[model samples]
Target: MNRKIYISLAILCVLVLSLQAACFARTPDKLPNVKILATGGTIAGSGATNTTTVGYTAAVTPVDALINNVPELKKIANVSGEQISQIASENMTNEVWLKLAKQVNTLLSQDDVDGIVITHGTDTLEETAYFLNLVVKSEKPVVVVGSMRPPTAMSADGMLNLYRATILAGSREAAGKGVLVMLNDTIHAGRDVTKTITDRVDTFRAPEIGPLGFFTGDKPVFYRAPLRKHTVFTEFDISQLTDLPRVDIVYHYANNTGDVIKALTQAGVKGIVHAGTGNGSIGKVEYPAVEAAQEKGVVIVRSARVGNGIVARNGEANDDKYNFVAGDNLNPQKARILLMLALTKTSNPEDIQRMFWEY
Candidate 1:
């Protein structure tokens, strides 16, 4: 065989391979044609050699395994998965939330993808969902699903939760509901939902503020939709995160120490959340340090150390004078979450408060 002819044949084969790869990526043969973004939650896992499947981690389950385990999904929609991360939700960072929000926004601009599903660990599920709800620009459903137990555990709740989330994503009824947390058979607004129990299959609930709805026999049943305003797919692109100002959380507790207040100021933290005691109250001991930190230019937010209900300002004097803001109904931790996101848009304490009110 001539050497030149052999070389020419190899080049021709390489070109064919490139074309084939491109065709597979762009072709739209998959069903209901939905997109599932997997973030390495318990819903996409199996049991280990021991532990009765109760404990789980973001292991090696790819996107296909989720659909394959629940073949009944085939009758509902044509879905595909994009493995985004494998870390537990507790470790999730602002950067990851921003990235996820941007990715969903990009997909929503496409004409074919009907909805987006996020599979996440239950620990910080609400935070991720809320982050998406506040930022992803779409009336198309962006549903977050997680299981209380690992799939290998007996009576694992992951499968049913996944099914419910899938139904919500495919249904036209879920439009304009914002990002949702579908777990324990309930559909909760992302920011309003929280994990009430660490071990129960029904670990998620809406507190005094209840779920928006539930799944009844593969159907989404809505009772009350949230009336809050959101800014998804708006000018709130996460690409703006690069130069965004910082936001921090300050927790108020009985005799709360001022260590964080002093530390954050040194770290140049631009914002602070005080998870205060009753009604976002700060202890006398911690107040001066926080006030001093704020005097130096940090935005101080008073949030409840308690987990439930809206936090508010009562007799806490000079809160307005000191340019401090109340967390409203958000816990200190959650207040931190919303504040960081809001700070991406503006620095004025007043404007940041309004962003919270609107969202």
Candidate 2:
């Protein structure tokens, strides 16, 4: 009949190229790619009334409309979005934390970048996730999401917290496990996550250490493993760090006369943290204006406003005769982001108190 119709069209082109090589050898393996930079907080907030979640209008939606309203985050990573900033995470800045830590260490020194989420704004999202858990030298997966409502409110929890922060940034067991902070489904440990309830969507929490795990249905179930010493064992190298040393915190209270620690050490502020009262003591009329701003060289540190624990390096705060450096469980705004990257590498208060007890 025409050579039997060319052998039935060559056996239907070999079963359509063997079913397109087994559908390209099973498509599911190509997932982990994650990028999502965005920095508008309240998960790119905006509210005119979806039942308004507290006078909204922060970071007013962008990063591709917050990843196109999270279309289930394309079945978990291979995602991409950039938008760097829109504001209102309390106007977070150290120049946007050195432009989001040099664009997250230049997209994690790419080789097809396998992780990084960051959508910040839960009011300084744990101080930019503990300053990218001490300058991300990339152990891979660096999450840091946010959302205390305001993605247009009404049960709006930023699209399931940006789909569980893109499945914990394409988890490979969230590699190395340092800078993470996913929201309600919990995962914290951007050096001890904070933000305890103000607008509530489970307002993050890691006090006394309570989360390095959670997200049951979507997997990622860790169980305590952040022994500090983060990312490629960090030494705080912001790759030629542009500028970041004016640290300041000061909050003691109860007739506190630390005059904002001699007015932030006469507004030159090399370092200051304070935030004392209980374990981080300091308000006996604010220790002689923090002992004259540490005899003018200015390194202080203390930290406590009693929100959780650890401020203990030396009991009643003599801290080795006033060279002061306690802030252990961090929290005076992450002890001013580790005293501004440990005064950019050592001003020596016992080597910045062993870099605040090993980061």
Strongest candidate by lDDT: 2
The sequence of per-residue lDDT tens digits that candidate 2 reaches over residues 148-221 is 87877778887897898888888889888888988888898888878888877887888778888999888889
Model 1, stretches more than 4 Å misplaced? 1-31, 49-53, 231-235, 243-245
RMSD of each: 12.7, 16.3
Question: How big is the positional error of residue 348 in model 2, measured in Å on the Cα after superposition?
Answer: 7.7
> Over the stretch 1-359, how does candidate 1's per-residue lDDT look in tens digits?
69999999999999999988876453336444678898877776677743565655554577778778887777677777787887777778766777787788888889888888899988888778877777787898889998877777778787777877887887788888888888888899987888888778788887898899988888899999878865453345575564446777765555667987999999999889887666667777887888788688788877776787666554453567767777778666567777777677666888877766666
Candidate lDDT scores, in order, read 0.77, 0.84
Index of the highest-TM-score prediction = 1
